[model samples]
Target: MSISHRQTASGRPLRVAPAWVGAATPVAGSPADHHPLPVRDAVWIWSVRRFARLALWALPASAVLYGWFTLGVHVPPGPLPIALLAGWLAAVSLIALAGLLAGSRTRRIALTGLLITLAGATLLLPLAALPEESAAARVALAPGQVHTLVEAACAVSGAGVLLLGWAVFRSKLVNPADGVLLMLAAMTLGAGSYGVKPVPTVGALLLLAAGMGLAWTGGRLLPRA
Candidate 1:
């Protein structure tokens, strides 16, 4: 159910390893357990959790604000409407990020949460965007539409990379538990490249390669919980 293991990485671009629990350690109500929180480690984890949430919420909130200001005032599928739509998508992505966050925390709880969250996104995104898309659904967007959506969404991903990269490589905010989630996110980006061209021969292969690379890397470096 866990989307990815939480990483102890401080600051790195991609998850350089797999994430897994090393062993079943002690828990409260067990023989020697007494504390409600791991006072020594819990504080740091809490702060990391908060930062992750803020980072995710930022993109969607901005887009939502922009949408309200621009296209919400008029019919969608127009100039500002297009931009707002992209923003809404960014919000959905942030929700996914939140799932990753949960997965990185309590494992069992995260599994059900991630499933429900992604199930909704997978179903809803296509339905919402199909109206303006091309029959092929490639950059079926009109001239400026693709550019607008692509750029904004990519920007959100880019910011996430920068911030999370810093946390994984430089800061110690991420532990090994979260590495896989990050790598998965990176792979998804590569997959979305298909939206740009939808050239199955090239795009599909690229996405596959990227996803495999992420899987391989995650399996290698992170602990297999």
Candidate 2:
């Protein structure tokens, strides 16, 4: 029987496999020879991806709900409205998280903006929960230092949103137009806070567009399976 031998670069003799066996064997360090993810790691990855996708889609739905309830229907500040608004804010937070997960180039900026926005939203929640007729609510809502603080919080939140929009604009994950829409949305929404007529509606529509754009980008992240 005849056998073949190969020499390594280091001058060592290397045994060559038979033609049939070599054809079936995968070459070391080849792409096909890579190890697969462990079950636990695989599951974790899948879960994270699923969460990102859901978060992206939720943004648009939450924006619509918030806008419709707060503006379209003029819902009074009560348990239902508060709950809806809270949900919307939560969804917005998730969208930020999804952006981070999507590996945006400006993830740090996005994260900072998210934290600032959450802080503002937190400060506003207690006031929103209070009954309008209550003395405490009246005091808080009165045109004074408390009202000024509220306005400042709103402005801070708007600034945070603007930062987030800028991050999105610079990120490679989504269309730049979406970021423009988001910035405009933040500005118009801030204007609405100051009693600008008909601007809130436009802001809500812009927000919807931005959210939809993010959702579209997220959908592309999912595996085709």
**In terms of lDDT, which candidate is strongest?**
2
Worst lDDT 10-window in candidate 1:
12-21
Estimate the TM-score of every prediction. 0.29, 0.69
List where candidate 2 sits over 4 angstroms from the true fold. Answer: 1-39, 70-83, 86-102, 131-143, 222-225
All candidates' lDDT scores? 0.39, 0.63
lDDT of 1 at 164: 40
Clashes of each: 34, 0
lDDT of 2 by residue, 114-181 (tens): 77777777666655555444525556555345656667767776777887888888875567887898
- Model 1: per-residue Cα lDDT at residue 161: 37
Clashing pairs in 2: none
